[model samples]
Target: METRKSYFFVGVGGSGMMPLAMILAGRGDQVAGSDRALDSGALPAKFADLTAKSVALFPQDGSGISSADQIVVASAAVEATVPDIVAAEAVGAARLSRAELLSQLFNAGVLPIGVAGTSGKSTVTGMIGWILHACGRDPTVMNGAVMKNFVAPQAPFASALVGQGEAFVSEVDESDGSIALYHPKIAVLNNVSLDHKSLEELRALFGTFAGRAVTTVVNVGDAESAALAMSLPRDRLVTFAIDASADLRAENLLPEPFAIGFDLVKGGERHKVRLSVPGRHNVSNALAALGAVRAAGVPLAEAITAIAGFVGLKRRFELVGEAGGVAVIDDFGHNPDKIAATLETLHAFPGRLLVLFQPHGYGPLKVMRRELVAMFAERLAAGDVLVLPDPVYQGGTVNREVTSADIVAEIAATGAQAAHIADRAGAAAHLVALARPGDRIVVMGARDDTLSLLAGDMLGQLS
Candidate 1:
């Protein structure tokens, strides 16, 4: 279906919803959105970032949904009791799931590329966006995280690029099973792992999404990704890997958080690419993007140039500030794999490490508590410290048994430094007081954007 000339978003401040609203508004749609946070007179700073664009924000009350002609779009979190939903229903406005509306735009374009996986979707989106822009293709990129490269004075991050070129790249979501909606011209599968959903559910959704594409780019290093790639039509699959044989493989890779750079060996050709981001996981993210770009018909040499100029995304290993000889790092690492990756990277540098991790949700911890404890115990050295705050979501219906204390106890059982702070403010203050000079303080979590802000506040205390 073609996009309507006007749109109304139900939760505009969301990481996923904000960029999408900006993209549609950039396409010249009459766009407005409402959020409960705005209605209750509490607006997070993240929402303020959208003020630079032409889009309008309203309270979650029916005020934002006045017209029947305009399409209503909502994220998975939006409920039927919302005033906008009620208004749309009363006025006979068409309510579209965020994925439905997003997939429509993606399919409408002449060139549609999807980056999907449990992790690295946002990073891959940034990588591919940079590659296309550097090749002078000027592709439109829609991502969950803010791309540092696209930041302007007014719009510090996030963009809805209505480029002259036909290519459009986006990171697809699977948390609510929305990944099924997208059918890309080129599909990139990073790695399949447990997070918000089960692997079986992830596999089916990602497999179906990739199979519908004209060309599917996949990671051969991962078993689930490799299995998904093998199921696709051979002619349609372009494989990439840091290991195993494939169309593109990253060889001689070295990740440094301080330098944020790596060297890649592709097809007997060795070229070092500098990434302004930390961790080995990001190197893998770059390879996934490179694979998708090649599958989309970009030349090998030009792909190198695009990535070299690419800066990292916001809140994913983001370096907020340094003061009092302490460097504060903010990352969206909530899952086992991501936590392990972050800890492993920081260990490479010569400094004591301290983690202020707020688990994203109670449900995710219940699913992966064992893995979480095991990974942290294995990676963290004797001097490293880990602080935990209660899981971020408290206002909803969920299993009550799972808590940060449970995960903390498990990690502590393995002889690692771990603590559970009942309050966010106390946790931030404790980290500041405990931090020694030259210690790397990393604030890690998901679902809540406040973690980044808290990291900044911690930096202020250290300063």
Candidate 2:
């Protein structure tokens, strides 16, 4: 009864774009895309997964944009000079930003849940999606990271789940100021911090996002989010916290190497929850998910039970393997807050951390270089080692003023063991060489999926 549409994604290999393509293709839409990564054959596995879904893939030289009826969806980062954009313009094809298309689909849902934050967006989105799916709600979930719980042979990259249900759960990005576009019935704000934008801009964007929702789930442990929660009507706010008292609270914390357990308290009821993922940060993430689903009419007890089954997202403190008493972990700790949380969680145990952090981009290094240096200087133990690689730049015209060497120099001045190796492979080799028995080698960064492969290679070398 519905007419199928055609969409051509410019950067189809992107974390955000890939999932949207999958969701569209799964829904019986004609989906095709082009990516520089595909043409270069960098991530063959990712492109193969797309092809397995019957989604056509092409090189980035504008060969995919065939007709005027096709909608060209691209991220804000796509410059007008891109071949896809040039082809689309020449063909008179309709164009939409990734956020515009996602919001268009999200806003049409009967019950839309938009999860927004500086960090933990993917984890919380995956949690809410898993809980709904486990509880048989059949939610349509869109995430930037692949959910381990949803991964199957056919759906190798199960970041987006297209379901025939009313509830649609998606993580809304605030980096490009697109969080304002989504109209969510239930909004979840995990925490507010300086990531892609300044605190002032983030505050205004996040405040309006939460205020528009019929019910809002907020983390009171974060000062900025707590302040925003106070500004919203109390009746519509559902608060969660680990250190601070709130409507949904996680107490009696227990941290382990591969898992964490805590007692979740809501009203007069309390229940123990154990997640396969490690860290106090994940406990906070779980509370946010519980609060969100609870606001969506899922019972507290049911949400807790379903959340306990959550494994976690790939690259979110994922342990690749343990060999010769050394563990290699892959994490998506790009920003200051995310890196701090990863450092804190890793520091909770007794092993020395050999952290190889690749900055996500030169632009972010310009913004948070000082904070990153400060976090590393404060968080790294006396014997711990930190290695830095030049940020990931995928052929873009960006200011390279703030290099990783500057960050390492600043951190070294604070008496921390820091080194900058312009090459990521050299950085990883350095970390591996510094790794000792009982030490955990963490490959941390974002915007690059090869970090996981690097972690695997480190594990292989260790073995």
Candidate 3:
């Protein structure tokens, strides 16, 4: 746990591992690691940024660990048979999961703000970080996605920011059940739904997370979140909502294609707030950010002003390009709730959608097969087109009983134009042929880093 010790990450290039690596390296730790992606030379720009910041890059061939004094960090997905894990075991180095290491750093002499939920964890974390940074708090932020406000020429991958302040803001994941590791000063629970686990299991994990925080920022609009808030002491709970009454609420809501304007009402004082990110879900996210910063002793008006300038995180309804009157958007929405929220935002505007959705993995597709079909069937319009490519393969043995074709078949039954293309290239070609001047082509998925690149390439073809 010493800042000056040597640390090696097993999957260093992953979204979760990269930011932690950068933060450790920035704090004068000797950070080095490797990934399967590194061996294949994928995401060159991200690896280059890490190397520039003094993080040693290595292949996944077990050469990164040479001594027993170095601590080896591995993500939850890293298997015991992996070379990095084996090497660390052979060298007698201390091994820690990514969440364990992050919890250690977060709990060390800093005011920790943990954002936990099934969705919108990264966005809320970024919003809180931006508000604190803009108000001169100089907070260090560790996020899973690149915050556009912190992106600079030298730091294209702005996932983590090392600042000289007392606050440490991070998004905690519940999928792997690591959210219980940290006792945060302020905990923000966005919502509870089915994503990585069953509903009952998620409730228990999130309830414990909310119970440990000094101040719990609960979204009252979500029923499960509201239920958790009711169990906490009155003084320890700070609530925000868009529908029901709460400590912070958004009234007179207005939703546009890429922006939303609303009145934030707190303590009978109304402040007009506008966000650059689209969707009603983002309005809920904004309220959670407001309550979090308020609990951290930031004035409500100052936090509201900073929220307006927040430019949102990458791949969260990111507009890649507009060519020939056709716009292509890149989004990281894989689960049913996330996908439904994105579709609702797009439908609010007046454009035919050409959706190309790739399932993140086979396991999730099988778990949420019925819900996925029902979502696409009910949400998609008559003239809209839904195209699906096979789930991104990451070298795993999975049951292939439920596939993309099943979802497509269900959607087509509901009178929507849907197709399942086997590869991304074929899906892109089909989208190019079907795209018209007034249509918006949305490329959506999760877990895969190349989806953003594919979105840009789709734009090029339209032009």
Query: Candidate 1 — what's its lDDT?
Result: 0.82
RMSD of each: 2.0, 1.1, 1.2
Query: Worst lDDT window (10 residues) for model 2?
Result: 1-10
Off by over 4 Å in 2: 1-3
**Model 3 lDDT vs. the true structure?**
0.91
List the candidate 1 regions with Cα displacement exceeding 4 Å: 1-4, 40-49, 260-263
Clashing pairs in 1: none
TM-scores, all models, native as reference: 0.94, 0.98, 0.98
Number of the predicted model whose TM-score against the real structure is largest = 2
Put down candidate 3 lDDT per residue, 1-463, tens digits, no spaces. Answer: 4679999999898889999999999999999999888899888988999999999988898998999999999976788888888999899999989999999999884789999998899999999999999999999999999999999998999999999899999999998899989889999999998887888999999999999999999998999998888899999999999967999988888988899999998887989999989889999999999999999989999998999999999999999989999999999989998999999999998999999999988888987888888899888887999999999777646678888988888889888899999999899889988989989999999888889989999999998
Instruction: Return the lDDT, model 2, position 199.
Output: 91
Cα-based lDDT at residue 388, candidate 2: 93
Global lDDT for candidate 2?
0.91
Model 1, span 1-463: residue lDDT tens? 3444788888787777888888877776778888766666554555676655777888778887777888899875666776788999999998888889888888887889998988898889988998898888988889888888887777765645556687999999888898888888898888898887888888899899999999888888888999888788899888877755887776665666554565566667877777767777787888888878887789877887778788888887888989989999999888888888888888887999988998888888888877888888898888988999888772546785889998899899889999999898898899899998889999999877667779988999988
TM-score sort, best first:
2, 3, 1
